[model samples]
Target: MDRDKEYRDACNQWLADCMLIYHNQVEKIRKKRLAAATEALTLCIKKQKKCVNETIKETIDFDTSYANKPSSVQMNVPKKVLEDLSFHSYIRMSATQLENLVSLTGPEMQKNNCFKKSIGVAQGLLLTLKFLAAGDSIYTVSCQYSIDCETIENIISTACKAIWNQLVLNVMPSDLSKNRWLKMAQEFEEKWDFPHCIGAIDAVHIVMQPSSNESPSKQKSNERNSIVLLAICDANFIFTFVDMGTYGCNGEIFRASQIGCAFENNDMNLPKPSPLNENDTENFPYVLVGDEAFPLKTYLLRPYPQKDCIEVSRLNFNCRLIRAQKTIETCLGILSSRWQIFSKTINMDVDKTMKIVQACVCLHNWLRLSDLSGNSCVRYMTTELVDQKVGDVFVAGSCRKSSERSGAFKDISCVGSNVGSRKAIQIRDSYLHYFNSNETLTRG
Candidate 1:
């Protein structure tokens, strides 16, 4: 009996030992696997980093030989840039203008010491202007400017934010008093012959993604992820108001815009409805002119339908409406043609891209106010479109001839209905009658 009990205890001890050994072996295997997995993950991340920057490398060979070469920056770069007339093709601003911009934005652009020493205010501004004006790839700009890619991007973002903060109020003031609007209305009437017109409204599509971001199926199609720039321009081709960061047709985007929402709520601070002339019986409200894609409203006017143009009065109205709408088109052309950034697909993050856009908008207004076009300004302001004889005679403006914009946001045809309220139609008829009348005057 004693021997039998001892044998059972020995067997139990052996079983326990085996179980312990098994667990120990399992732990060793698991530790190896964990280390291997962590190493693999680290390698994967490194590979992704390289791939991300190299996706478009085949198209343009970047000289990363930058590190081995002498420093890519120079103190005289701004001066050289200003002296090179050809450089204007890359950055459209003049020396004095660029310097003035530096003065306004230099404080904001100032930076503290970091990974790489911060470039000077002027150099950083030059890099930003060149990148924005030409839409050069980040790597390309970095190599050309002798700056790091991340540094350049930060510089651009800072400069743009500075521009917006400094100039948005003075250039494109949203809270313009009634007096300012009256002045804008005066300019429209004198230039476009569309009395009581404050501005021309339109929407432009700016592609926010590169072709690589789209799936293969979508890449082949016309579809791309994009945002709309719903802009209103005065007779002087200055952006008075701009709302963006939406994706849709013009009508949908317009409905979602600030001006459109204000119009819907009847809360905008527009001039009250008044007679077209002292002798006129009906009172006409001040209005904005847009293409047929926009709904005709009491406060907004679009051209008559093609079928309705059978009558001479309707034809004349359409002609005049189209003539005023040219301001929107001209402004878009000038914006795109001069800046050149809107001409290409933007590959950056959406937030940064938006800041750049705001900066560009402010710059456009500044340039117009400063009269950067010099002698060309006189030619640009020359009378282009004339409908004194209606559709029977017309001439394209010098702006249209000079400003064949590259790849700026394009004007799109609206698929939705634009036929508006009875009151809106009545407003259109009143304008139509006023335009056809021989008594119509150019003075607002």
Candidate 2:
């Protein structure tokens, strides 16, 4: 009985200790909760004070007069001053052409606000054009236009986007009809003396400055430091199609491969195959002539490799094909010369750079088709008709030989071996025969 009594007393003592420990834990939790609540309240009060101080400061410093004030600086190029300015010097367009562009893109580019006045559409258009034509940095352009650098950037972006969206449909159609392709083919035959040709395809390296955050390895690579602009131009210097923003590190062959995917996928509405000569019964598809950098496809013709020069016929075929391909090179030269922006390394965001280039192409097409066509800027464009009149055959051949030295020519033999079919070979041979027999080859 005494042992049982001692056990009961011990159990009671253990229970008492457990209750005391539980009470101590509850008190500690209460203190923690109080500290957390106090900290949160203090933070909330601090944020509210900051907000109130900011609001009060903004209200006190707000100047109503500044909102009403006009820009102290204005565009100095007035009508009389513009008259004195050369058409090519002022935005690389005739004044009449500039007016026409303004008419098309004005409504879309105009911005307005109730408190602060926005830039006028006319001023904005001029600013954008001068920026592109001058190839000036945003800060330099902003100073000339009497606007902030940020404002100039906004204007340029908006104007370029507007120009591309508004004019690309009319200038460069994605879905060309059968008649349109036929028209291009006829022009190629008549002007370039090349049959069954619709366009000349090529790519150019648009120089760009490497970003600060780019890796040292990437910056060191030439291709990584530039952009590739792939385009197809017609017998005229107008761009028929453009695919921009490809990485510079990629070769022209890579860009062409992307188009090949579209062609194979039946997404590209290519012209239907027809006769090489009007009298011939066997049909041949219209083809685009590109340099050796591109792979040989049934629809795209590249020259024979340097080692493949076994016969005069092979050499003649390369010459004629290069004659057709020269259109794209001339178009690129004219574009770069006119814009001046393309001649140097473009230091801007990739997207902005693309839009600017796209805008230039649209303007080129517009200028080619516009009534204001007497501008001297277009005289730089190479003309097949002029060369034909002078009986110049060696010019294209010489150009091809010179171009081969640029190291851009790829060994496309392996790639072409699989893709080029027997039928395409026959079509190329037929053209070679036509070129050899039609006219006596003469030196340029």
Candidate 3:
């Protein structure tokens, strides 16, 4: 009986000890998991703090000194010249304002070392604008600014890419509502007496350096050979669409046709047309006005042949076409004359050239917006025209008496009468006026 009791007590004690051991082991595991979790959380917090600190540092750095410094270690452009060239007028943004824009554009340019390093982002951007505005050779720009050609190229590429990808893409309003487009169409009708016109269409050549022998076959086409740029200008003279990559020597009519097809195929961002009917035909139909190079389709209108029996009618159509198409010429003229970079052959690869072109377009829009927002004098001028005398016989036959013209022309007579109810008469008068004005002036 005594041995049995002793053995039983020992077994109970052993069981108790094992249970305690097991509990201790479980507690130890719990502690280890807690420690590991705490360590992981602590490490994450440190990483987050480091990131916050770095961001704050960057913000502070940009806010304090980014705008005042030059883009490179050495200041290549003279301080005075840089100051003078800096857009500082009512039409130009201040340094701080430009810096904010740079900050907004910084992320897109972060991959570029030229943008990431020594130069102020604004200064780098300014250099590129100067290049575009002056149309100077890269070598000449380099010599004038005292920066290496490579650096100038880098700055221009980075700045242009970022501006195009960010500002132009985001800010350019694309609301092509029928009402808006129709309003533009109506403006053409009222101002230039162009019936059922949607917008004025024309192509301008932006000269580029000859393509390399190694250039891809697709890029070596006739239009791409010399770089012809096609653009459709709104009534306000703003370029709504620009298509490049055609050969320079390609006829404007051919290129305009391609663009029209592209618009039909939805290649360009043209708004879709609604169904057509006779009553709405004169108002709702979208049409493109071009010179003799383009065919006469219902959607596309061209001047009547000068040699046709309807010579007066042709003259009228041409005058209206010129009045509307003048916008494209004005836009191109401003681009080439105001921004020098476009007037001369561009040295960069085609891809870079495209970005630069886009950037300039965006910049032009920006300037226009700025100009409109304020009452600045010296708004950019339009294309010049010289007045000349038209043969009286041609004018007399083509121009109908105001009383003889149809009702539609009379209903819009208030606007048309200023020039004249007859299209041929208006054109002849404009030509005469152009010729008499200045010998150097060229018709738009």
Candidate 4:
């Protein structure tokens, strides 16, 4: 009887403790809910007060203005139909939208109070875009906007650098992973039947004013003098790598060798060439397609000699390469066509010129990402013509085998066979057909 009584007493004590814990938890929850409700009510009251204050201020201002006005005064004025102003028609962006984009770069551009006050972000962006879209010189742009030349230049340079560093580099598709590069290679192969192509390689001559300090030996002939820009572009016509220090008139072969050496030496952070797989048909590893300017290496493919094959085979190869190489050519065309700075002889120092080129390329990539081109047909034509030119150049004589040269030349002389006769005619006819076609139809 005594043991039973003790057990009952312990059970009662346990029940009492459980009730106490539950009561504490309920109290905590209630307090939390009450605090949240108070915060929400306070915010609502604040907002209501602000609205009321604004309404009272507006009412007072209106009353004061009405009290100062003369009630009986009237004057006859000529009626005018004010049509919507077209002055802003060419401006594709509003001041607010441009300011938003510029603000996206970061606080550095926004913090410059003098800059912000002098030129609104919208006006600055419109000026730069006008320079790009219309290919106008800085002088011309300055005249149109009634801005000083130095001010215009400074604005363009600052804005371009900001856009390049923040928007272009930060947002560009990276080629860091091998998996992504391999996927790109596969896409190139599928589209153009060009195997293992990560990108297209080419060179362009950027005309520059004669350097006053250049020695006689450094200058090219009087007819042509400029700096050469060697570049590699990806499928989207975006430059993956660029080399701009070479002088004009350097042989394409020499430039290719330099670039190859740079890759071999790890001078640039280029992907290292891998050994060929056992099953690989072409022993060439890490290849780039180029015109005759490049040598006949395992890593590069040029066109067959003009005399060797039927026209159909040459035409086919040319067409394929043209489609592949179009990216680089289009890159150059866009650079020259959109940026008038490159269209004429650039007078800036070499370092500044290179920076401008890089800035332009970065801008092009950014614009492409934004899909800002309104007219699809015009864009297509611009890209297509560039590809066709690359194809024609590659098909003509770029890919001749070194071993076959001596023997083939002897045989061609003896046989008196027409060189590259088959493919040349087809390409010529196709080019003419393209040239003669209506622009609208061609774009379609």
User: Which structure among the candidates has the greatest lDDT?
Assistant: 1
Best model number under TM-score: 1
Sorting all predicted structures by TM-score, with the top scorer first, yields 1, 2, 3, 4
Give the least accurate 10-residue stretch of model 1, judged by summed lDDT.
Answer: 59-68
TM-score of 1: 0.73
Compose the digit string of candidate 3's lDDT tens values, residues 303-344.
555766254444544666666665555555555544556544
Give the clash count for each candidate.
1, 1, 25, 8
Residue 161 shift from truth in candidate 3, angstroms:
1.5
Question: So what's the TM-score on candidate 2?
Answer: 0.70
Global local distance difference test of model 1: 0.71
**lDDT tens digits by residue: candidate 1, 1-444:** 999999999999999999999999999999999999999977974453343433333221111222112233542242233344554555666555666777787666564231126566656677778877777888887787676788877878887888898899989987667788789888887887888898998876666654566577765533245566788999888899998786655557677777788877877678777776678877778899988888888888999889778998888888888888888888776666566677776766667788888988898788777764462222212234212344766555444532443354655576135879999899899898888887763431
Clashing pairs in 4: 292-398, 302-399, 303-399, 306-420, 307-419, 307-420, 311-422, 311-423
Provide the lDDT at 9 for model 1.
97
* Model 2 lDDT tens row, 1-444: 999999999999999999999999999999999999999977974453343432232211111222223544444443322233454476766555666677787666654331125465666677777777767877788677577776676778888888998899989988887788899999998877788898998776665778789899978876666556677899976899887655423333343456656655766676788776656676778888888767667777888877987988789888888988988876766666556566466777677778888898887787776623565333323353223334644344223332231322122212223246786677676666666764524411
lDDT of each: 0.71, 0.66, 0.55, 0.50
lDDT for 162 in candidate 1 is 82
- On TM-score, the stronger of 2 and 4 is 2
